[model samples]
Target: MIMSHLPYLISAYGITLLTVLALWLTTYRRFHQAKNKLDIMKKLNHET
Candidate 1:
């Protein structure tokens, strides 16, 4: 494949992909942490 503006295209694609991956990781980490906390809370509540 030939791109007339290879530098610009490469930068754009790299940035876009990185941004998406970062957002996905942030959301996934928050969700996982929240779920872990919720499970711990539930366990504590059950024991009491």
Candidate 2:
């Protein structure tokens, strides 16, 4: 019955959410690191 499949559907939804969150965290970390490097470079350029 369709009602019996509710647990499977819920599990799938949880897995999908975890995957998306992991991907987002990885992307955010890379973006922050890149921004940090840019800031350092800008500071160095101004000093010269």
Candidate 3:
């Protein structure tokens, strides 16, 4: 049975989780940065 490979399975799942979390954080940061730039541009455009 797969029970014999329990350690390997757990490690695989852990690596996958960390990868997803890293990807989510990177995307979230980029989105906020882009939004801030856009807001600044909009404000400048309105002032002109």
Per-residue lDDT tens digits for candidate 3, residues 1-48, read 789899999999999999999999999999999999999999999999
All candidates: TM-score: 0.87, 0.87, 0.87
Which tens-of-lDDT digit does each residue in 1-48 have in candidate 2? 998999999999999999999999999999999999999999999999
- Model 1 steric clash pairs: none
Cα distance off (Å), candidate 2, residue 30: 0.6
| Model 1 / residue 15 / CA error / Å | 0.3
Per-prediction count of colliding residue pairs?
0, 0, 0
Poorest lDDT segment (10 consecutive residues) of candidate 2: 1-10
Task: Choose 1 or 3, whichever is better by lDDT.
Answer: 3
CA lDDT of each prediction against the hidden true structure:
0.96, 0.99, 0.99
Query: Would you give me the overall lDDT of model 2?
Result: 0.99
lDDT of 3 at 20: 100
Order of quality (lDDT): 2, 3, 1
* Model 3 TM-score (2 dp): 0.87
Q: Root-mean-square deviation of each candidate, in angstroms?
A: 2.1, 0.9, 1.1
